[model samples]
Target: MQGEATGGTQTLADLQHWTWVLGRAQQMLLENGIHTMEAAPLSGWSDPSAFARASADFWTDTMKLWQRFLDPDSEGGAGEGEPAEHARDKRFRAPQWRQEPLFDFIRQSYFLIADHILKGVDALPGIDPRQKEQIRFATKSFVDAMSPSNFAATNPLVIERIMETRGENLLKGLQNMLSDMSKGQLTQTDANAFTLGENIAATPGKVVHRTPLYELIHYAPTTPTVAKTPLIIFPPWINRYYILDLSPEKSFVKWAVDQGLSVFVVSWKSADATMGGIGWDDYVEKGQIDAIDTVRNLLKVDSVSVIGYCVAGTALAATLAVLAARGEAAKVASATFFTAQVDFAHSGDLSLFVDDEQLAMIESLNTDGYLDGRFMAATFNLLRGRDLIWSYVTNNYLLGEEYAPFDLLHWNADVTNLPGQWHVDYLRDLYRDNLLVRPGAMRIAGVPIDLSSVKTPAYVQAGREDHIAPPESVWKMTHHLSGPLRFVLAGSGHIAGVVNPPDAQKYQFWTNPGETGSLEAFKVGAKETKGSWWPDWRAWIAAYSGEDVKANGARVPGRGNRKTYGDAPGSYVRQR
Candidate 1:
């Protein structure tokens, strides 16, 4: 099964081959009573009266569906009546579904059964909570897989395309699937449509310094006069740093440079066996601290503004706390955190996967010293299963269609490995222990971290719909910071909320002047503002940036003791 589907040579027959393989696997599971035991909670007719009532209701619905199917004047089989809101979930959005009654009936019936099965499982006598969660997750996956959208035979869009192209599209889709399999993954984007330095991370800059852990990039100043205080950005090492430098129009790095602030970004290396021993302390010392020192030295500034995104922001906060203890806090002018959480108490769904059992399982599987990037990618996809998983599956497998190239999706697929030590420590100390928010709970570079001691003026932003770092979790940062803090809630989920460029002006943001309270209270007091939050952030950071100096255009790639290591979006970003 591994090598059966060769790239470019896959025919429509390959689809049938995979289907047969799946059917055989299902048969094996059924014959072994896997389904019966897994669904034991729902298998028995424990109460005869309730069972009889359910049977009658099922029969009634089936009769109505049959009547609708036979009625010529019926609105093209629109199910007996409109489906409940859950049945009409966006993932099932196919024109034929609502336009054709049979498909609608099939979808509604599937959801109805799914709801009942889940209810029965929840009511089961004395299941372990962890086991119940695992069971429910598995059940949801099974139900989602059985969706009509996941099968060509049941999907009207796929049927129409097959009839139109005489099955060429099917063959193409098979080749696409085979090609992706050969690469040891599924095709999430049109990879051929993108080249790293050529387009995606095309922002102009130079790598000023390089280390085994990261490369420090100095973006060419877009404005003539730059701020006296340079701005250094630390993006999460989980993915490549290019998300901040995606395209010129949407690039946060570019936006800052245009605002007359000298910008430097840290592009982290993809971890491997060689980097398996790297820990959180190494990230702070060699990764963030080293970059900050280099930027300060180059600009000859006593203090610099810093920005951290996601996990990087958490690392930055810890670093600042360490610096403050050492009386070196003067190096920071102000701190800006984007979708970063210092408190893990409200860290959302991601926390569910970090318990002892799951961590132990992950550790056992990651014997090679690093967590595979694909595993991380899959976990995140599960958080938004309908949009990221099922939708792509339906388009590629069921509809036999090629994915159109999308920049953000491409970036999402370009995942990087995580060092085992760093990953384990992060999960245990932060997610499991909630240490960052606790005074003296964590130590970095020989100094204990207390976020409250770090009194740098702060601006914190969180996405209202962020699942990975819930806004409430981010909101807690205000209480921990000793300095004046301003918190803003942006629209959309994690990535989309932050990547929103000003010109695009797509999402709205909320702000409450001088507001300080719990997240719910803040929400009640905040007023909505139209357009990107970038402008608001720009205005806030400007006051701390100091007056702009005359454009020197002096700092190019190979200046001072720091020689240019390479071009912007350098070698580290190009690493697999």
Candidate 2:
């Protein structure tokens, strides 16, 4: 019944729509630079005979497909039930099943014929590149002009599931698919864009120790109690170090010290061959484990609280696991992970790049043993191609617009390369195989990773909109730990989520460990606290800070008269 109504084009509007559809053949050719200018009108469209022939071929095939449902003489009559099922099944056929190769051959042949016609057009005169750019932009605007809502409704690919159905399931699937795709695109756009503070004052404070993976910097309190417990902060090596204590107004470390906690953060060194051979195990051992020993000896503290951010959290998890398995777990007081993951099974979209074939391709490149950071940045960029790739192409080429200068974009564009070996091992072991979550699945320097033995009180944070490590993937760390655990869910992606400062516009969260039945249940009743999660974390540490003893927390010999680096925004940071 429905098929007959659609087949019979009774209204003028229907005929006009079909006419516009046929016109798309010419428009698509124009987008490819054919017939775009008087000097270079599409060569293919140059010959009236050839253009008419191709137009007939395209329209004929399209009508053939359409007539299966719409043309009264071709299919069902007015009283017949819809042929929706057949159409849907046909549309859903895989690319190969759709004879895509043959379609490609036909498309190429049309292009060849079009080129012959365009040659005649090109002989007329040359067009300025600037004008050509405007033409390109105008052509692209046809596709880009649709508002988000209109695109959702009119996009044929999106509306197809509902097009052939009469039941509730059709609406449900359409709604869900639209919602999912919309969120996916939005997340992709957000991930690739961020704002940066301009003319950021660069001054240095504290001395730093450099390792192959990073440089450890410490800003000790000016007036320290005779003895102060040192807090070592391990930031993810993915970006520059200052994010934690960005400035006096928003400095997380400075806030902690005001609460009387000594602080040290690892300023991850930019990549070079000397760092290329470094892998997860190496980072855990030399990067983290050694740092612990150094801080422990330097400060003479029996134990200290350790905080890890993102990838650094993964490193901390492994380090603690190795320590626990070796029966040497007393050096750490507590552990905190900000959006870190121990299990990769639920990693959401990041999993797209982690399958066997991709890993093999990466292995082929990592044969030199270090994954270049540039390669890692490129892979991440591809994941958000609509914004990161197309937006730039549109602005720089199609629109001929000057690249807008922004600090965050500068930082993003200033991508650093990851060592080949580091990435290969990380992807293969953690993401591809989910090794970290497997019982005794991971080993470092002959030590098996048994996270269940890690009794350090733990705090784990996951971001709600995070694409790199979704909440589901990150929260798994709570399940693996043996100690009382706190899991926090923040609002933004990897960086913004963590850097989230407390404001009415934002909120931070927490609840007592095991105060509720499960992570899900606890989240339901968790208290919402305003402002940066950083301050709350500082308070949490103070509560757990061992009683202030008669002696200072920990004392290092080189503490006083130590040379302070230039100031906030040091020399190396400026170099970037």
Candidate 3:
């Protein structure tokens, strides 16, 4: 019955509702007998030897701690109290955690038990590695959910706030949760604080071209004279393209225009049931290729510099390979990739959730032809649970505090759905099979994609702390590209690293003079440079850009053979 419902067109809310219902049914079945059979080895406390070993270790550690506490004259006693080795852990940094010995004792005891339980589970006999991994991930999720820090009753900071507020905060927190639930979503940031065109994607531009797959945006030039070679940006369709054109001050699109470059951005349509048939080929042909053609037609230039971020970079690389095969490689003067992974072997923690079992489950949920954006958002939030999940939980629930409007978090919440076929194709071909880097393994637009054939001088930027596309994975593109490659390692995580503006001057970047085959060798030879990687990118991209020419005045809305669809952001970005 549930499967039948999933097969039809369902809204995110409907899908989530059915998911809950099915999940509960599964839980009930598991609780009866299936869990017992499957998790028999995981129930290690039932084993006498395992229980005894854990108990013995626990007692030994407790007794030693007790002895240390009692003996004033001991080597590290009252006169020289030893600090906890884990004191630096930010999670336990609350004043009450240290001021009250009881809290510390409780915390330490919890860790002790958790450690033993994990060890016992790990030592379980005859369990498959994949099953063991699933068990471990589930255990960690359970442990984290039950953490004292997550609950107002157990958290010291929450208790202090409660005492100060005289319980008013708790009521407010309940109200906030109820409000968010009413909207059928989780609250990450104060959504009410942001308006799309007015604040976020406010850069002046016009939607000069539109297709079923995307809207081609030509941003108004900021300089009297612009570079002859136009710059076309292909952003990941999984999220709104506004991330690059965020706010005027931090807008890469605006900055590029200011630098005397004609900037064109492709805004991908949020997928729906109508777009179910849209596959990887459609994205390349009707999406990137179409946008490139629009830019070329509008600017009347044969060659254009290109920029791609995250998944878009992967698609763009394939598009270039196809173009190169067709003898149209000169259409792209140079290419820039921001935190994009061409080689999936080192794709980081995101890979853990992409196994056969998980993919099958995902396929079931995507039976309606599109994966819900909210579902994708939840998966990403899990990647950094401490920052994206529990922190928000504590702020909105325990403290009853509303989130301050943050631009990046706001953009993150503004997600777009993926066509079912495209999503599965990406997971199967690139991630599961690791085929993108392999020549003749995959074909796009009827041409065999070979990354080695893509010899356009490339600029690749990877965030050192990026958990999604790890720097090592992004660096692998250097080995595949036959052209001159410059790889820069930026400080901070994925989004922040790419969005770093020169005026903000927050994160630094590392650069090596030349590309090396080995990622480790590149890192060793790289030198640290202060400030945003944007400047370095601009300089490199400009090198490939042709000489400055009189700026072609901004195209009038709905002018020429290709009429403007709407405003800069277009109708697609406002879908959700």
Candidate 4:
């Protein structure tokens, strides 16, 4: 009969009347627990304000009832003719409904409630609930189902305390998330405030070095120190270098100096429209390689033990590969990668954001030659949207809370742009294509990358919770490398995994005996221990340094009367 309505024999007026009735009936059924699940989506509005206005008890009960309805075991987990373990089976059948008198009453009450709303809006005629015992029982059951859970597993008391303290914790969480979205739009840093002058007369023995790309700065050993080979540190370009040298007490660089190790850090140049033409190779050539030349020339050293953190470490690996292919691997004495990705093929959750469609959209807009830093930040925040976006929306907008200005928050806001071609090529080739690990899959400056040829002794760190690069993804690099590899699985995410201070409690890492042939064998031989990997890394790096030198090494000629090349912290950082 419904299919025949298409024919002209069925009058258009009758069809319209049927459509109205059906629509109203659906509204009644959906708004109330009729044939559908015990709980349903809120009607009329779907925004946060509507959610806030909703009765707390009503929502709590609705969620609980929905949870139970979804669990098959709640209905014996099986119907007649179903196997004993049917609930665990993928094709398990649901238990049949009993359709008792109480069910009929709830169905009628649902229609009545929906009718009230429709009539109030002049859409339908309202119905009054009958004073029936079954109807009253159904109504009470519905209310009981929706009421907040008091079970210890649910921890309703703790939840209430958090709600009270955090000011509608859910709402506050949402507001913080929205605020993060807005803050992500801006690409300014409130963390890169310290200037060389601030540290300039503070320590006389400190050697402040500046690179063509970055003002390469460091503290040199004043007294006689072990011939510990010069250690060059590389931090991710996504963030400022100070993350490694955060502060006096937490500074990894300061700790290295105390360990009697000579350290030079490649503080990457902040990118701008001028750097739009620069690609991955250019960063290697003008950035890492350039820093190496400057340090060697100034320190008068033949080779340095290089340490690269996160993205910088990946770049270092590429540079080393390029150098090795050209028979120039002797420049590096040893190498250490901190939570870096040489092979991004196994990058789990992050893989979702780098598909073909997203790559195309990014390339089209990045035609300006650079992928704006803000866009990258926004993309990362979206990965954890519930925490970074919705949480803020609930807090600030719904609950009216003040935003906290944390240093990490400020630093997070400081995003740097990536050159268009380079960024796209990296995603498509390394991430989407998994070319880096494939033998000779990548070419740098006309040089093919063969990890087997890279015989540089290496130390690789993998963060357990790192979303950007998982432990497995980074550990995969060891298979491709021909050299001795020591891979450590560290605690924390991408940032904390690398920037970990020496004394941070609860931090742990696993180190195998030597470069245990493969990642699997490495995991077996691995031993877990507490405390940051900073001290362990420092000890490992110190052993790689050649014996102490008698003569003072190369030194950058002082500018003396010449105008300082650039202002403190320089003009390049502000280009964006």
Q: How displaced is residue 318 in candidate 4, in Å?
A: 1.5
Over 303-372, each residue of candidate 1 has an lDDT whose tens digit, in order, gives 8899999999999999999888989998999999999988888687788788898889888866888888
Question: How do the predictions measure up, each by TM-score?
Answer: 0.86, 0.62, 0.86, 0.65
State residue 443's C-alpha deviation in candidate 2, in Å. Answer: 1.3
lDDT of 2 by residue, 230-297 (tens): 67888777766666665444456656655666667776666655665777777888889888887776
Off by over 4 Å in 4: 1-212, 220-228, 514-521, 549-575
Ranking by lDDT: 1, 3, 4, 2
On residues 1-576, what C-alpha lDDT tens digit does candidate 3 reach at each position? 322221223244543443344334323433433345545544333444544465567557555544443453677542134346456656677766655444444455445545655675676555677567667766666666656678775576777777779888899999888987796567888888888889989888788887888888887777788888988999999999999988788888888878888888888999998888888899888888877877787767888899999999999899889999999999899999989988998787777788888889888888789999988898888877867888778889889886898887889988899998888888888888999989999988888889999999999999999988998899888878788888899999889999988999897998889646787888788889998988888888888898888775433234445667677787889996
- Whose TM-score is greatest here? 3
What are the lDDT scores of the predictions, listed in order? 0.78, 0.58, 0.78, 0.59
Superposed model 2: Cα runs more than 4 Å off: 1-204, 222-227, 245-250, 367-369, 386-410, 503-519, 547-576
Cα lDDT for residue 433, candidate 3 = 91
Per TM-score, what order, best first? 3, 1, 4, 2
Q: Considering only N, C-alpha and C atoms within 3 Å, which residue pairs clash in candidate 3?
A: none
lDDT of 4 by residue, 361-444 (tens): 988977677787888787776554544544444334444456654444555665677777778887888778988777778887
Q: Give the clashing pairs for model 1.
A: 77-101, 224-551
Candidate 1 lowest-lDDT run of ten: 1-10
